[model samples]
Target: MNIKLSVVDQSPVHGSHAKIEAPRLTVELAQLCDSLGYHRFWVAEHHDSVHFANPCPEIMVASIASVTERIRVGSGGVMLSHYSPLKVAECFKMMATLHPDRIDLGVGRAPGGTGLTSHALAFPHEPHHGDLYAHQAQMLEGFVNGTLPADSPYSTIKVLPDSSPKPQLWMLGSSGGSAGLAGHLGYNLALARFIDPDNCNPAIFDSYAEAWKKAGHTGEPNRMLAIACICAETEEEAKLRAGTAVYRKLAAQMGQREDFLTPEQVQDRYKAMSTSEQAFYDHILKGYTVGTPDQCWQEIESLAYQFYCDEVSTVTVTHSHHDRMDSYRLLAKHL
Candidate 1:
C-alpha cells in the first residue's frame, strides 16, 4: 500500500509556552511540512475554542499557498452549514485561481463549533434542513459547473478569472451517512478516523467502495484517511507527548474548557484522575497511531491496506512544534 503524510493546521495551543509562540509557530510548521515532502497540508475551521487557533480556513489556506510551491493546500474542511453555497464556490474559485493546480475543496456537514457559535456565524433567518448538507453540495456543484439560471442573482456572477481548472472536491465525514453519499456522488472521501474512533471499522471503507462501484463510477475512488499520528525516536518519548494530547481531549470530553495544559500539567492531571477516567482516555488513545517511527509506519500501512485507502493524513500534537515537525520529517523519509 502507498502511504502519504499530511497535517491539519489546527495550531493546537497546549499550555503557557504554546501561547507565547502559537502564531509564528504554526506558520513555521506549515513551511516545514511543505519542505519535508508531505503530500498535502489542510486546516480545520473552528471558532470560540481556546485550544484551536484557526477560525477562518480560507485565509489560512491562502497564507499557506502563498509560501508553498508543490504541496496541495485547502481546508480539512469548510463547514457547509455555516455559509452560502455560492459564497463558498466563489471563495474556493478565488483560491484555485491563485494556486492553480494545487487547490482542493473539502466540505463537511458539521458546524465545527458549539450551538451559540454556530448561530453567530450562520444566516439569522436561513432555513435549516435535515438534508441541508446534501442540498448545499448539489448547489455548490451547480455553481462550479455554471449551470445556475442566467436571470437569477447568482447566475451572471461568475467566479472571476476562472483560469484554473475546477478545484478537486472532497466530502469529509466521521460517519457512514456522509461516506455513502460521497461515494454515490463520485467525489473523493476524507474519512475522519481521528474523530470517530469507536466507529472506525474497516467495513466503513468497504461500504464506500461498494457504493462507488454500484453507482457506476468507473474511475478508482480516492479515499484519504485522517488519523492522529505521533512518531518519535523512542516509544517512551512518544508516549509522553501523546499524554499531553490525551489530557486535552479528556478535558474537552468532560466539559472542562479552560487554559491549555503543559506536559507536566498533563502528567499531573493524569495521575490525579480516577481509574474510570484513566480507562476512558486509554481506550480513546488506543485507536490513535502513535509510537516509534517503525511502529507508526507499520500501523499506518496496515490501516491503509485494510481500508484500501489511496492516502493517509497524519495529524500530530506534540508539546513542541519542533517535535511535531521532526515527526513528519521521519515519516516522510520512510514514505
Candidate 2:
C-alpha cells in the first residue's frame, strides 16, 4: 500500500522558549519539509492557547507557500464557525489566485480557542452560533464556485480577484459528526487522530466513507489522517522525548488541555500518577508513534492501512527545535 507523508506544525511553545519563536520555527520546518519532499505542510490554528502560538493559519499559509515550492501549505484548518465565509473565501481565493494549485482551504468545526473567545468570535450575531459551521461551509462552497441560489441573499456576493485552480477545499474533523458532514459535502476529509485516538476508531472511517458513498460522491475520496509521532535515533530516546505528549494527554484526561509541561516538568507529574493513570497514558502513547525511524515507519504504515489513508500527517513536538527537525528528517528518509 502506498502512503504519502505530511506534517502538522502545532507551533508548540516549550516552557523555556518564547512564543514569538513559534512562527519562525514553523516557517523553517515548512522549508525543511519542502526540501525533504513531504507531501504537505499544514499550520494549525489556535487562539489564546498558552502552549500554541499561532492565531492565524492563513497568514502562516501565505508565508509558507511563498517560501517553499512543491509542498502544499494550508490551515490544518480554519475554524469556520468563528469567521465570515465571504471573508474567508476572499482571503483564500486571493491566495489561490497567487499560489494556484498549491493552496488548500481546510475548514474545521472546532471553536479554535477558549469558550470566551468563541463567544467573542460570534459577536453581534450569537444566536446562529450553534449551526454556524453548516452555514459557513455552505457559503464557502457557493463563493468558491461563484454560485449560490439566485434567490438566496448571498447570491449577489462574489469573491474578488478570482483565478483558475482555486484553493482545494477540505474538511477537517475529529468526530463522526464532522466526518459525516465532510462526506456529505464531498470535500476531502482530514481526521484528527492525534486529538482523541480511542474515539477516532476505524468505524469513523467507515462512517465517513459510507456517508460519502451515500451522497453519491463519484470523485476520489481524499482521506488524510493526522497522528502524533516522536521519532528519534533510538526507541528509548524517543520515549524520553515523548514525555511532553504523554503529559499533554494526561492533562487532557484531567480536563486541562494546556500543554505547557516539558518532559522534565512532567517527570514529577508522571511519578505522582496512580498506576491506573500511568497505564492510561501508556495506552494513549501506544496509539502514537514514538520510536526510531524504522519503528515510526512501521507504526505509520500500520495506521495508514487501518484507516485506508491516502495521506498521513505527523504532529511532533520536542523541547528543542533542532531535535524536532532531526526527527522529521529521519522520518522523511524512510518515507
Candidate 3:
C-alpha cells in the first residue's frame, strides 16, 4: 500500500538543556522534515508543562510556514475547547492568506493542559461540557468558508484579511465516537493512534470510512493515522530507546502526568519500578514501532494499510535531538 508520510513534532523539552532551547530544537527539526520531503510538518500544543514548550500552535504554524517552501504546516492540533471558534477561524484564515494551500487546522476536543489550565484559558467563556467541540467546529467551518448563519450572533463578525482560500480543517481524536463526529461534520479525521495503546481494533477504521460515506462525503475520504515511531541502526538500540515511553507510562500510572522522559529519567524510573509496574511495559509498547528503518517501515506500513489511512503522521521522541532527526531521516529513506 502506498502511504504518504508526515510528522507531529511535540517540542519535548527534555535533555541536558535549558527550557528556552526547546523551541529552537523544534524549529530545526521541522526545517529538517520540510527539506526531507515529508508531506506535512505538524506541531503540538501542550501547555503548562516542562515536557513540551508549544502552548500556542498557531504561532508555531506561522513560524514553520515562514521557513518551509513545500510542506504543509499545522497544529496536531489546537484544542478548540479552550478558545472561541471565530478566533480560531480568524487565526487560520490569516494563516491561509499568507501561505494559501499550505496550512492545516487540526482541532481537538481534549484540553491541551491540566483541568486548571483549561479553566484558566476558558475563564471568561465558562467551560461547558457537552457538544462544545462539535459546536466550535461547525462555527469554525462556517467562518472559514464565509457561511456563518445569518441569525447567529457571530454573523456580523468578520475575519480580517480574508483571502481566496482557507486552511484545511481536520478533526483529531483517539476514539471511534470522535471519528463519527468528524465524519458527520464533513471534516477530515486524524486518528490519535499514538495515544490509545490497546486498540488494535480495525473496526475503528471501518466505522470511520462508513461514517464518512454516511455523512454524504462524495469525494474521497481524507484522513491521517498518527502513531509513535523510534528508528535506530539496530533493533536492540531501537527497543532500548522505545523503553522511554514504557517507563513514562509507568510513571503516569503512579500519578505523574508529565511523563515524557529522557534516557536518564527512563533508566532511573525503570530501575525503581515494582514487578507489577514493570509488567505494564508489554501493554504500553503495543502501539509503538521500534527497529531498523526497514523493520520500522514494515510496521508503519501495516498500520497505515490497516486503517486505510491516506497519510501517516509519526511523533518521534528520543533522548538525543540528533537521534530524533536521524530516526526521521532514516525512516524517510526507507519509507
Write one digit per residue (lDDT tens) for candidate 3, span 207-260: 777888897878866788888888899998887777766666556667777635
Q: Which tens-of-lDDT digit does each residue in 1-335 have in candidate 2?
A: 88899998888886556777878888988999999989988888988887778889989999999999899888889988888888888888888888878988899888778788877777766735447687678788778877688998878765774434578889887766687887787778888888878788678878888888999979677889999999999998898788887777678668887646767777788788899988887888887889999999988998888888879999997877777898899998876
Q: What tens digits encode model 1's per-residue C-alpha lDDT throughout 30-112?
A: 88888888888888887788877777888888888898888999888888888888888888888888788888888898878
Which has the greatest lDDT?
2
Location of the lowest summed lDDT over 10 successive residues in candidate 1? 122-131
Clash pairs for candidate 2: none
TM-score of each: 0.92, 0.94, 0.94
lDDT of 1 at 110: 82
Query: How far is each candidate from the true structure, as Cα RMSD in Å?
Result: 2.3, 1.8, 1.9
Q: Give per-residue lDDT, candidate 1, residue 67.
A: 88
Model 2, position 146, has a per-residue lDDT of 75
Question: What is the lDDT, from 0 to 100, of the residue 292 in candidate 3?
Answer: 95
CA RMSD (A), model 2: 1.8
| Count of steric clashes across candidates, in order | 0, 0, 0
TM match of model 1 to true structure = 0.92
Sorted on TM-score, highest at the top, how do the candidates line up? 2, 3, 1
